[model samples]
Target: MYGCEWDDETGATNGFFQDGYDGEDFLSLDLKEMRWISPVQQGFLTVQKWNKDTANTEYQKQYLSTVCIEWLQKYLQYGKSSLQKTVPPHVSLLQKSSSSPVTCHATGFYPNEVKISWMRNDEDHDEDVDLGELLPNEDGTFQKMSTIRVTPDELKKNQFSCVVEHQGKTIKKTLTDDSLPIGIIVGALAAVVLLVVISVVVFKVYQKKKGFKPVSASDDGSNSSAHSDAKA
Candidate 1:
């Protein structure tokens, strides 16, 4: 296999080639350090090493130098744009924490740089807001939440809004008393259904384990017939 590993944060990179599993030391490079730690840096040196000859380690030095330069140029030119593209976040109301507490959820956005806060009657409200951390999404995006407690009286007197800033855009989602996010509602219902199903399965398993059996329809009918005959 032939490929390179580059770390954007520390500017560390390595380029290497391997012939096969349990193969001879072929070509390896610490491109960032500009050092040859093991194996020959050139294909010819690799061939020489494989054949047990005195190998020229820098035989591929010029080529590796060129690769390093190109790598730096790519990072300088297109690194930020390659994996740093922005995606607008979806904002919605989460399930309320209490009768008065409402949470605003923002999800599925890249870059993870987001601002979440509350707005009361078109004014910035921060003292009561509880902002959550940037949680990673399975899709490599991010999710976050911010909650605020507003009483029914205050909600009736003033409008409450969650302002989310991400991807160079501002999203203002209004908080409502009884409305939960559609995703949250569906997830909750699915969870409850799953719990009920699991409970039933567990109950059946426990009953079987205890040698308890359910009465069949015929057995119930037989018992009813015996009871009627006894009364007669």
Candidate 2:
């Protein structure tokens, strides 16, 4: 139910309008595609509901349902436009620490119209990347692969990204390193800190027991009196 042309110059879809507005307990096409809706799935729909007495904004269930139906009717009538005009953009992140190669492939394109490049921290990759051939599809679409041989030092910046340009727009998706698993690292650090705290508590108890010696004052006084009598 998307890609509904607005006017002559702006043939873009009205999907953005639906995106801006929201409804409650109502029917919807897809989030992006905005496909068609069925009558069977129409009943029990609730959009923005209002009070009959006060005529104020009471519940939004009935209101959203009405909006969805109106948008769907217009969407079906003007949704005949083709999605083939713009090439679908895609980027993959394949991480490899081996000496072989790190390759990423992207498909769903309108051949020769989309351009892709490999970059390491926004710099042009010269000797590292090996560009692959573009394969064509039955619908005149194309797919391409780009590979880069990254060194251990190059991966230190932790900012490798793939840049794709098509239809006067640029999009990028960053690559993540396999060596760094955030959850595991945090768990290991927590375990180490717990062990250190337990060890410190155990050491304090051990020292208190070893250094303690109990004595009575009456025994010392009697021994001193007997020693004074012997001296007299």
Candidate 3:
């Protein structure tokens, strides 16, 4: 496999095999550090040989360094304008239980620099906010989260929200009060719906069983004739 450089100042990694570009299946290497970081570990014979050869070619460092720098420059210059975009966050509020902190998650954003806040009654409440770090998504986007603690009494007031600032847009998501009761209500409603459906099905089956069944045409005529004879 192939890898790329990690820029410490910018806190990003680049050039990860380009997703269908040139890459070997089992020969991983760090081209910038000149190290076999994977597949050719320390105890391998191939590692020993490669290390020896690399040490012998110390004079080639200048050329390799130049190539790495130029490659980075070319990619940074050509790709940034077209490939980079700022994606807005999708905000949500979650809680493990009634007593847990309200975790406000802001996921699916790009550029990795976003500000998340937990507010009370439209005012910033920093004392209760626990800001989390930016995390990378599988699609090369970023996600972040923040949380705030709340008591049951405080939750009853229902004046809490999570706000996100990204790409010059502000998005706020409000947290609901008494989530446990709401969940119970929803579950009870579902159960009631299920019961009603079951009752309707059972009633239909019972009615089908109790429904009148007409006799054959000849039998009905014979019964009517017998009744007429008895009445006469």
Q: Over all chains combined, what TM-score does candidate 2 have?
A: 0.38
Listing every candidate in turn, what is its Cα RMSD in Å to the true structure after a full C-alpha superposition? 12.1, 19.1, 11.7
Q: What is the lDDT of residue 94 in candidate 3?
A: 75
The superposed Cα distance between candidate 3 and the true structure at residue 3, in angstroms, equals: 15
- Model 2: weakest 10-residue lDDT segment is 47-56
TM-score (C-alpha) between model 1 and the true structure: 0.49
Q: What is the TM-score of each candidate against the true structure?
A: 0.49, 0.38, 0.47
TM-score of model 3 (CA atoms) = 0.47
Q: Per-residue CA lDDT of candidate 3, range 90-173, in tens?
A: 887877667778788888898888999878888778877788888999988888888788987887785888889998899988
Candidate maximizing lDDT: 1
lDDT by residue for model 1 (50-109), tens: 434214335444444457657765776776774768888999786534354687999998
- Model 1 regions more than 4 Å off: 1-70, 76-81, 97-100, 178-188, 195-232
The 10-residue segment of model 1 with minimum total lDDT is 48-57
Candidate structures ordered by lDDT, highest first: 1, 3, 2
